[model samples]
Target: MAAVVRGMFALEPAQHRAESCQPGGRGDASGGETQPVESGEIPRCLLVGPKGSGKTALLFQYGLSLVRQGRRVTFISHETLHTMPLHVAGATKPDPLSLKQLQILYLNTQEALLKFLSSIHTQAPLPTQAPLPTAILVDDLDYYVSTAQTAESAPVVARLCAYLVDAAYFISNKLSEDKTSVAGRILCPVVATVAPPGDRTALQWYERFLTSVWEVKGVAGQPTMYQLSDASSAERAPLVVTYEIGGTLRVLDVQDLNEPMEGDD
Candidate 1:
C-alpha cells in the first residue's frame, strides 16, 4: 500500500490529485458526527531543497500517500511547478478537496497571490462548526524573489511573505489553543526550491526569507543531496548523498552506496 519507491523522490499518493489517489475516503463535515481517531497520529512533514533537487517529486509522492489515507492536502506551487501538466491536472481535480467542494487557488501573479492569502485572514467561521483542517503545501519559494525584483511588485511580494509567516504563526497558535481544531489539526508542510544567489544582496535576501535551507549538488549523472542543518555549515560542509533510480522509491532500503561514485555516461 505504501507507494514510496526507492530513489524516486515523489510526493505521497494522497497529496496528488483525487483522480489518481483515493484511500482514506473523504472528509464530510456535514456528516453530523465526527469519527474517532483510529491512528492516533497525524502524518505531516516539511521538505526544503534547491531547484531540480527532487523537491516537487517528493512533494507529490508524499502528498499522494497522505491522500490515499483520506487526508485533505492543499498543494501550493509557484509559477514553474504549478504550470507543469501533472500539477495543473491535479489542481483541477485535487484528490479529496475537489469532492469536498474545496477550492485550490493557483496564483501566477503577485496580485492574485496576495488576494488569495488575504482572504484566509479575513474569512470567519460558523458558530456550530470548527474551521476546516487545511494541509498546505507551498512549492518554489524562490519565486518570491523574482516577484519582488520589480520595484512596483515589491509591496505585493512583501505582503505575501508576511502572509505566509502569519499563516504559520496562526496555525501554530491554533494548535496550541485547541488540540482538535482545524488550525490545530491542519498539517502544513512547505517545500521550497532555492538556488545559490548571484551576489551578496541576493544571498542576504535568501537568508532572511528562508528559516531552513538545504543543498542539491552535482547533476543528473553525478547527483548529491545535502540537508544543511547548521547555517554556517551550509557554506562549509553540507550534508551530501548521491542516488540513482532503477525500480521504486523506498528511502530506507537505499543501499550499496559506497562513495560519491561517478555517474553513468
Candidate 2:
C-alpha cells in the first residue's frame, strides 16, 4: 500500500516504495515493446546487525503497523519472546485489542523451523478463524540457517528461505491477486533479521534471496544509539535513521535529504 513507508522495514522510504519493485511488465503502446509498468511490488527485506542492535524492536514496530491497518502478522522466532515492545521510536503505540492481531510462533531449532516452513508452504495452514498473515517476521533468521551443526545445512537453509518467500509472501500475493492492493492495504512483505556473521564470506550466500538489505549500525560517538540504513543501495548516499532503545524506543534524528516527505506516518 502507498501508506507503507519506513514502518515496512525501517528502510529509506524513497527506495523501497511499491513503485520500485513492481513485478511483470506491460506493452509499450508507443514503441510496441514490453516496458515495465507500475504493478504491485513485493518487498523482501533483510535486516542485518549484531546482538542488541534493536532489530527485534524494529520488526515489532513493523508488525504493529500492519496490525493497525487490519492485517494479521506472524512473528516466528527461535525462542519465546519474553517481552512485547511498546512506545517504540517513530512508531505509534499499539492498543491491546489491536496487538492481538500480531501472533507469535516459536520454533526453537533450525530443523524445526525449516520443517514448519516446509509444511506451511504446501499446506498453508491457518488457525480455525484467523485470517492469513499480511506480514511474516522471522527474528534472527540466522538462528535457522547459520547455527546448523552439519555440512548439509546450506541446502536446508536455502529451502527455508524459499518456503518463507513462497509460503509467507504467497499469502500476501494471493490476497492481493484480485485486490491489486495487497491484503491490509499494504504490500505483504517478509521482513527478517540476522546477526552479522563472523566470516563475512557467508553473507553473499544469503544476499541472493533478499531484495533489500537494511543494516543496524551503532552510532560511533554515542552509546545505546543506533542507525538503520539500506546497505543494498550502491547508487547514492543512503538515508540513515538514528534511534535509541535504552528504556523506550525513541528516534533522536535522521540524515539524508533524499527520503520522501509524505506518507511517513
The number of the candidate with the highest lDDT is 2
| lDDT, candidate 2, 137-167, per-residue tens | 8998988776677676557556667777776
Stretches off by above 4 angstroms in model 2 are: 1-5, 8-41, 121-129, 152-156, 177-187, 233-237, 259-265
lDDT of each: 0.41, 0.63
lDDT tens digits by residue: candidate 1, 137-214: 556555655766565433543455556555544543343244354322233333334455455454444444333444
Compare the candidates by TM-score and give the number of the best one: 2
Model 2 has an lDDT value of 0.63
- Enumerate clash totals for all models, in the order shown: 32, 2
lDDT of 1 at 199: 52
Candidate 1 regions exceeding 4 Å error are: 1-51, 65-71, 79-104, 125-133, 149-159, 175-189, 219-241, 245-265
How well does each candidate superpose onto the true structure, as a TM-score? 0.52, 0.75
